[model samples]
Target: MLRGVKREVCLSNLTLQHPRPYLFVTAQCDHRIFYGCWRVFWATYHVIWVLLSWVLEPWVLYSSSERVKWFIYLTNWTYLLLAVQAVTEAVNFFCVHSLREDIVADQQAVPMPWYLKLQWLLYNIVTTGSFMVTAWYWAVLYKSDTEIGAVRVSFHAVNSVYVLLNLFVTATPTRLLHFIYPVLFGVAYTLFSALYQLGGGTNIRGEPYIYRVTDWSRPWKTLLMSSLSNFLAIPFMHLLVFLLRLMVGRLWECWRGSGGSEEGETRRGRGRGVTCVDLGQRMTESSSIQAELLVSCE
Candidate 1:
């Protein structure tokens, strides 16, 4: 009688959450479909990267020596990484399907799935490889004396921490971070390119020449709007980099000279020379640091 009551209670509990089980089943089915489709998507992207490298080869050659080498390396590494990832993902998908069939056939004694291990491995490889490549690009910029200020540094630091934190916290899934990552990357690249172009040349007073459309005439509303957008975006994008520079400047001052000393002024001048050397060193070090971090993160 007790055993019968226990069975009835168990059945009642299971029935009580019918909607939740239904939702879970629906999600699992959708995920399985998405996983299958993603294999083709990965393959398509791998081919695209290869083709892009071939197309850009001529332009890469015509660029500066530093730029040419970096671009070529970036292209090669990107293609290799994507190709490998696609292969791994494909294998993982097949393993998952096979394991699911096995489980259905032998429901009384289900073995652990091979696909879970493969999925985890692929995730580590992709995330680490991507981060390393990004760091390598930055290192190239640094070695070229790109002069990334405190604002840019801080932004990167924050971005890195945020990504790592997401990885650590299961509660706030990394998918959320992945969704926003591309947008952040696009905006940062746009701003960085604009700033590099605008700040490339200098004038008599050593101030960057601000470009603006001064005309207030009619029938130029569309042009005016376009111009405004460009102007806003450029500054907004550069603001982070500029802030980084400000932070570096303050750090330099604090290191070289305490306030209000003649020796401080002398130290400041000396510090400038040291700063140039330090920047170069930091750039080289950053590349190695990035490589190490990527491995560690993985």
Candidate 2:
């Protein structure tokens, strides 16, 4: 019977079934640090950074040769997705915080809404796509003489920082199976590139291709690059994220257990080090709420 509960708890980490809805809106380290200030500050910073970038993008584009074609770039698309994710994240946090009293008192599970699920989907895409954009741009598209401006850095490099920080800070769970979102996003962009070529679209300099590597004029080369990015790169990034989440969770558990009361530690019959089952049982014995939300055994 206990094995069944542990199995269920372990499986919950891989699925979108996060029973404790409150965890979605809270930061992973919020309880330990400055009470809850970290959540507010981080969420506000995300909102401000995205808003500033949105305002600057137009000015930067118009000043450069890209002009209206700026929106067609993958960097900008990922940036827009990140902006939406930030807004939705802040909204969910505030909404849940307002209902904290009722949610805590009743302990009733709130159903995850469609928009929140959409936000989670966007999170997966933005995180993976942001890193891809950064790596691809620097490795392939960057030119020595090209001007390296703040806006360009924000879109390419800093964007990855946002997603990486989000990975470690948020209490959100990442699933290995949900890698399909980034794969689909990559496929959609690849399809759009082909359609744009057929439609006689051109880049800023009126070239036939948006990027040299994606030039549809060379059909075989374009196809190869598309397949590599959509299949190979996206899946690799998602797997890295999934592993990082598990490692971070393990470190968090170790840190918390070290500071736990001596009586609580004695009750668990373990100190800092613990096996998977021992950790699961310890969490289960300590707090039923935590057991439902925190267990991530494999």
Off by over 4 Å in 1: 1-30, 59-75, 98-100, 103-119, 142-298
Cα lDDT of model 2 by residue, 80-172, tens digit:
787777777776666666756543232435666565577788888888888889999999999999888777887788888878877777767
Local error of candidate 1 at residue 237 (angstroms) = 23
- Residues 264-285 of candidate 1 have per-residue lDDT tens digits of 2330132232332243333221
- lDDT at position 192, candidate 2: 88
In model 2, where is the ten-residue run with the lowest total lDDT? 283-292
Clashing residue pairs in candidate 1 (N, C-alpha, C atoms within 3 angstroms): 149-244, 149-245, 150-244, 150-245, 151-243, 151-244
All candidates' TM-scores?
Answer: 0.31, 0.76
- Candidate 2: where are CA atoms >4 Å away? 1-16, 32-66, 100-108, 260-298
For this target, which candidate reaches the highest TM-score against the unseen true structure? 2
